[model samples]
Target: MLPSASRMRRGEEFADAIRRGRRAGRPMLVAHLKTREADVPPLVGFVVSKAVGGAVVRNRVRRRLRHLMRTRLTAIPRGSLLVVRANPPAASARSEHLATELDVVLDRLLRGRRSESRTLTDGRS
Candidate 1:
């Protein structure tokens, strides 16, 4: 289970991350990431809509994602907001596959952020 302090609980928080964050999509899920300057712990939220399945299936997917994120919390930067929105395919995806895709997406997002910061600091237009 994700710690309460690290879980995103408000609508505005989710909206901000989804609207302003960098996003990456996979067959199973889409991830949004926004880095902030505050010194708080990273916050994570999940979106599992009816398109994914009924309550049971949606809850299962959410639980799996929470478990996956628990192990990956350290990899996310402090003060960052991450939202993982599940695709319909995620309803049937294996745990390992979800973990793999989550890792790949996160690495891609973090790498992109790093390069973007480098470009801004490199003094080149």
Candidate 2:
């Protein structure tokens, strides 16, 4: 399990990730913030709410999320906070399902963002 400090988004950060971040879907939201002058960026936190379930169930979801992130981190952009919200349907979601969903959304979001940045960098408006 990821440490709480490393696994949970606080109130303001969570709100920012929701409101300003580029959302991948209903199940996940992601926002990237550059580190304060560092080459290596750390994955900060992931939040799964009680609306997801009781303690045991919520923690299970979080663990699944962390594992997915670990496996797929290379595809994830640097300095990003990924907030994966659990739908009620996900309470019983299998590990493979959870991993696939996270991978799909993160890959799509990252690809779109990188392509847009490339276009802008190439002087396209």
Candidate 3:
């Protein structure tokens, strides 16, 4: 279970992250990450729509995602907002597979952020 403080609960929070964040897409899920300058803990949210499945399947996927994010909280940057939107395939994905996909997507996003910051510091586009 994810800690309540780390959860993104409001509609605007989710919208801001999804609209302004960098995105990494996979067969199982799409992750959006928006980093902030504040020193607060990272916030995470999940979107499991009906396109993924019925209530039970959506809830199951959401639970799996929450558990995966709990273990990965430290890896995310401070003051970042992350939204994981489930693709239909996630409904049937194994926990291990979801973990792997999440890791891959997160690595891409984090790496992108790192390179971008490096470029800015180096005075290059």
lDDT of 1 by residue, 36-67 (tens): 99889999999999999999999999999999
lDDT by residue (tens digit), candidate 2, 1-125? 44443443477656655666666764533333322223444454566678778999888877777776665665545555556666766678788877777777776667777887899899997
lDDT of 3 by residue, 1-125 (tens): 99998999999989999999999999999999999988999999999999999999999999999999999999999999999999999998999999999999999999999999999999998
Off by over 4 Å in 2: 1-10, 26-38
The candidate scoring highest on TM-score is 3
Q: CA lDDT, every prediction? A: 0.94, 0.62, 0.96
Give candidate 1's error at residue 29 in angstroms. Answer: 0.6
Order of quality (lDDT): 3, 1, 2
On the 0 to 100 scale, the lDDT of residue 5 in model 3 is 88
| Separate clash counts for every candidate | 0, 0, 0
Write down the RMSD of candidate 3 (Cα, Å). 0.6
